[model samples]
Target: MKRFAIGDIHGGLKALKQVLERAKVTTQDQLIFLGDYVDGWSDSAAVISFLIELSKTHNCIFIRGNHDDLVHHWLKTDEQNENWLKHGGQSSKDAYAKLTLSEVEEHKKFFSNLENYYIDPENNLFVHAGFANMHGPQNEYEPYMVYWDRTLWETALALDENLKPEDLLYPKRFKLFHEIFIGHTPVTRINQTKPVNAANIWNVDTGAAFKGPLTMLNIDTKEIIQSEPVHQLYPNESGRN
Candidate 1:
């Protein structure tokens, strides 16, 4: 069975469906989603509902994103954060408004159960964003940093291309895992629209929330599959653009 790492979806269910179909994913395949499943696009609630069902049929590992956390907070307390709404939460709020109370509660439970990070038997670490601790995410002082931190990716990017893992200057945290896969900061920020590898970190977030496509990467083979650019699929919407 193949293991695939999916990038942030950002409510682009059409893009999500297209990539999965194009990749021909099977129930036997292990799908590790890197989060930000909701927000940006128009199908926030639908995306969550779809993922909840997908998990039942597939070996799926869901990681919590900062946006997902914010939505959960709003769902539980009915207090919407203004900042969250400004980003992509407004779309989520609008989409969720169509759901019944029971449905909302079910979605809230799904959000509550999401993991902050996942480690495979082969020592590959999957997280929504980066972790700060040299000892890895398990030892992170601020738990939320796992969903919000950019330092780990930045540190990896800043490292010299020729720097070997055994070099004294190599960051200690990179040594803890065979490889790290993350989503949050888009690779589009660097003007690339595909998964990028820096040191041992693989960034799969290809800006599906903006102009790029939804991406899925085979962790073992390093093969990539993507949907059409999100904006083209949802021509009427501006998804976090």
Candidate 2:
């Protein structure tokens, strides 16, 4: 069976479809979505709908991103704060334009309850953001903070060698995994530029929602398949402008 690792989607249904089609994913294949399912683009509704449908037909696992948390907070609390709304939440608003309050609540509950992260039997892990260097697999709450915190990323990349991967036991060490599949940073290289211990982590958030590339990594084979940024493919798009 083929295992596919997908990057932060950020509501780019087109890019997601393009990559999946290009990869020729079949029922025999498995998929891991790194999140950022909403915000940035005007197609959040379409993308979420696609995800729900795809979940039925494929071996799919979805992890919650920071943006997903914000959207859920708004729906559950009836407060779309400036922080979340400004960070590309307008697109999600547009997507939820006609949704009744009940519908919003339903959607909100869905995202809010999404799993924080996933660890395969292989000990390979998948998360929207990388793990916290200081707290990994410690308290169950650790995954929540790690997946939503940006500061953790910098800290992990700068941890003291003694307290880092080699010195830790099991998955608590961010670098204990043979490979960590992540998406948060938007970059040209999927595996990120840095090398951490024996593990190689990738930042697959190819920035699709920002008119950047959409990337996918075949976990078992480590093959990268990418699709052109949809926005850049069409220079004359009016709404996308």
Candidate 3:
């Protein structure tokens, strides 16, 4: 069975479908989604529904993202924050506006049950975002470090190109995993629109929340499948603006 890691989708259901189709995902494969499944565009609810259905037939692992947390908090506590609304949360709210009570409950369950991080038997780590501290994973790091930490990716990016892996002072967290896969921080932030490898960490968020395409990486073979430019798929959008 092959393992595939998908980056942040950000309500681009069309992009998500295209990537999955291009990858030719099968029941025998393990699909790991790095989260941010909602927000940005107008189909957040549709994205969640598709994921829920996909989970029924595939070995799917859903990691919690900051946006997912924001939606979950709003659903459960009826709380709203201006910052969250400004940062694509309004789109999510609008998406869910028409759902039935049962559908809303199902969506809530899906979000609440999402994994903060996942470590496979191969010692590959999958998280929506990186961890803050260099120490190992902790239960107390949720809703923050699990979905917002940039230190892990930053450290990998900061490594000297000339230094071999063995010659560097890699953090304990990095040492714990054979490889790490993350989203949240889009690769486009560095002017790239493809999956980036820094040390053993792979940042697959190709900015589908903004203007790049959705990216899917084969964890075992390093093969990549991507959709068309997200903006092209949603020309009328003001995604995450």
**Whose lDDT is higher: candidate 1's or candidate 3's?**
1
Residue-wise lDDT of candidate 1 within 1-241, one digit each (tens)? 9999999999999999999999999999999999999989999999999999999999999999999999999998989789899899999999998999899999999999999999999999999999988889999888899999999999988999888888999899999999999999999999999999998999999999999999999999999999999989999999898
lDDT (Cα atoms) of all candidates against the true structure: 0.95, 0.70, 0.90
For residues 1-241, could you state the per-residue lDDT of candidate 3 as single tens digits? Answer: 9899999999999999999999998999999999999989998999999999999999999999999998999999889999999999999999999899999999999998999999999888899898876565564445478898888888889877776656656456678789999999998999999999998899999999998999999999999999999888989988985
Ranking by TM-score: 1, 3, 2
Please give, for residues 34-114, the per-residue lDDT of candidate 2 as tens digits.
Answer: 888887766776777788778879998888888888777766676878877767787787788867767666676668667
Better of 1 and 3 by TM-score: 1
State the local distance difference test value for candidate 2: 0.70
Q: What overall lDDT, based on C-alpha atoms, would model 3 receive against the true structure?
A: 0.90
10 residues in a row with least lDDT, candidate 2: 190-199
Q: Which candidate should be chosen as best, given lDDT against the real structure?
A: 1
The better candidate by lDDT, 2 or 3, is 3
**How far does residue 151 in candidate 2 sit from its true spot (Å)?**
4.5
Q: Each model's TM-score? A: 0.99, 0.81, 0.96
Q: Which pairs clash in the backbone of model 3?
A: none
Candidate ordering by lDDT (highest first): 1, 3, 2
